[model samples]
Target: MTTAYWCVLIAIFLPYLATGAAKFFGAGYGPQANSDPRAFLAGLQGWRRRANNAQQNAFEVTPAFAAAVLIAHQVGVAEQLLLDQLAVAFVVSRLLYFVCYLADWGPLRSLVWAFGMAMIVALFVVSA
Candidate 1:
């Protein structure tokens, strides 16, 4: 498979990784863990809350990214190298976004999020 295809695979699971990290960081495991997962998440603070927010953000961006990839492929975009590079940029930006969110780097996280969105937009633009 192409690197772009592999990027799509990684994108598919990225949100789950964030969600798992949120749960782990929020202390949602072990014998004393709360039975209500929703309550557990709702009570999170600081970095844990940021992790959950990142998880939600990941979910929010995923469909757009996936659609861009699929549409770009179907429309036969001639710039394979550009498509691959943008795909990689999107994935890397997302990973950095997650880190920035968890680390509470508000401005940097916003910049990373914008970068990821830009990558997706570039995919569609290049394909068109």
Candidate 2:
């Protein structure tokens, strides 16, 4: 498996880890809930929604990376160093993107998301 593939896996795993961290820490709580765990549960639930979205995006990239690999092979654009950098950049950008999303940094998160997508696009384009 390529480094990019590993990065993709990490991207998918991060959301779950974040949610788990939220559970371990604490999120939502109210006097009416009659329980402190309720807030934590609510936090987990909210994290689930965000994690699901992240998962969807992560899965979308699998095929995109695979296609890039195939195109690279077919076109003989085997620039291994560039491919490695793109893969690493995609992975790191995705991690940062999710962090920003969870942090609720308006606009900044979207920009990171776009940057990550751009890396994927660059892979396909440069390979061709």
Candidate 3:
């Protein structure tokens, strides 16, 4: 219902998108297609790995967002700037992170990862 919620939802989806794209283009590097679920899943392992990254990112950000929201609500800081910024940071960092992960960007990926965590911390601090 809120921007933060939407950001989390987008975060939840990005990895799946990245994974699907990887599977689509990963023809030569994977298993032969077959009716077997195991074979089909094997063909999409690269996509699954990317999806794992997305899952991890979701796991990292969701708790922070929920905690920030609850803290803001309890502390009467519901309209705080940090909450909004957290959403922005979560979205931007996630987008960059997915790009970096998929494109094999090295150190820059770590920087984006740090930025996202810092944003979550900032939100927590402001809410507290």
Best-performing candidate as measured by TM-score = 1
User: Candidates 1 and 3: which is better by TM-score?
Assistant: 1
Can you list the residue pairs that collide in candidate 2? 28-39
Which predicted model would earn the best lDDT?
Answer: 1
Candidate 1 local Cα displacement, residue 74, angstroms? 0.4
Worst 10 residues of 1 by lDDT: 25-34
Local accuracy by lDDT, each model: 0.87, 0.64, 0.64
RMSD of each: 1.7, 5.8, 4.1
Alpha-carbon TM-score of each model against the true structure: 0.91, 0.63, 0.67
Across 1-128, the per-residue lDDT of candidate 3 in tens digits comes to 66766676776676556556544555543444434534454445554555446545656666765666556556765564557667777778878887787666768888998888887777667766
Per-residue alpha-carbon lDDT of model 2 for 32-66, expressed as tens digits? 43356435444455554455455455566656655
* Model 3 residue 73 CA deviation in Å: 4.2
After superposing candidate 3 on the true structure, give the runs of residues whose Cα lies further than 4 Å from its correct spot.
28-61
Pairs of colliding residues, candidate 1: none
- lDDT score for residue 91 of model 3: 78
